[model samples]
Target: MKKALTFLGTMVLTLAIGVTIGQVSQADTPSAPGSADDPIVTKSYVDQKLAGVGSGGNTGGAPTGGSTTDASFKVVTLNPGQTLKGGEGAEFILRGGTATAIASTNGGVSDVTGADDLAQGANVELNHLLLTPRNDGRGLKVGSSTAYVLVRGSYTVQ
Candidate 1:
């Protein structure tokens, strides 16, 4: 009985070691570098400088432009071939010059294939509940233009 127990213990240890090695090897494999064909990498800006908004701070240590509101503007723009996700608890407005947005949630109202095309001067606001999943919003892709502008809405991080 003791010898049988010893064999079982050894077997378990061997199996564990094998799995660890397999996982290590799998993780060590290098993925190809990101490219145009890969997923889009969107960038975020804290101010609306791209849209020609004046810098809102004092340059020479004196407050400028009277009393300014305490509103913070966050903008996220997608590159030509990239995609962006409005995180689970994020709210943002989608403004596009010429692009397509795909909404897929609640069993696919509009999947990626069913794109919501947008013309110049078009915008869509997406408001998500805090309890909702991050994938509830749409995936945006700029058709022929450079990128799509996203005006972030106010959201408190829980």
Candidate 2:
């Protein structure tokens, strides 16, 4: 009886050790870096800037980072086909060449301010939002005053 018990204890220890080693090795291993075929490494800006409307004291600096949780932004010009969600303090910037404005949230209704820009060949800045996901209002629009809305800017994505 003692011999059988000894054998069983040894087997359990061996299994435990094996499982530990296997898990450790599996975690340490890395996937083969993909090349041309396997798949290589994968890899916003605000629409408007509100000037001094003459407010009292300065507001909290939280909105600048975007949503408290990890968020992303989709940017497109001449068409409203993007969504904007921000990280903590995620600020977005874009260059729409003057007539670059987006209509977000409200669809084609056009209710938000800074959604339409009359500026051309220039850059516009929009302050990040606090609630309601991101700072996008309806869809950005490119007026007839301009031909193409060139885009340039950065937003946190995680």
Strongest candidate by lDDT = 1
Candidate 1 matches the true fold with a TM-score of 0.31
Model 1 residue runs over 4 Å out of place are 1-71, 107-133, 153-158
What is the C-alpha lDDT profile of model 1 across 18-118, one tens digit per residue? 99999999788765556543323423342344444445554444447674322343655665655554444343444554444445545222222224333
Q: Please give the distance, in angstroms, between residue 17's alpha carbon in candidate 2 and its true position after superposition.
A: 0.6
Name the lDDT value of residue 29 in candidate 2. 72
Model 2 TM-score, 2 decimals = 0.23
Clash count of each predicted structure: 2, 26
Alpha-carbon lDDT, every model: 0.46, 0.39
Error of 1 at 146 (Å): 1.4
**Per-residue accuracy of model 2 over 113-153 as CA lDDT, tens digit each:** 35532222222334312122244442233344332222223
Q: Considering only N, C-alpha and C atoms within 3 Å, which residue pairs clash in candidate 1?
A: 40-82, 88-134
Q: Give candidate 2 regions above 4 Å deviation.
A: 35-39, 43-158
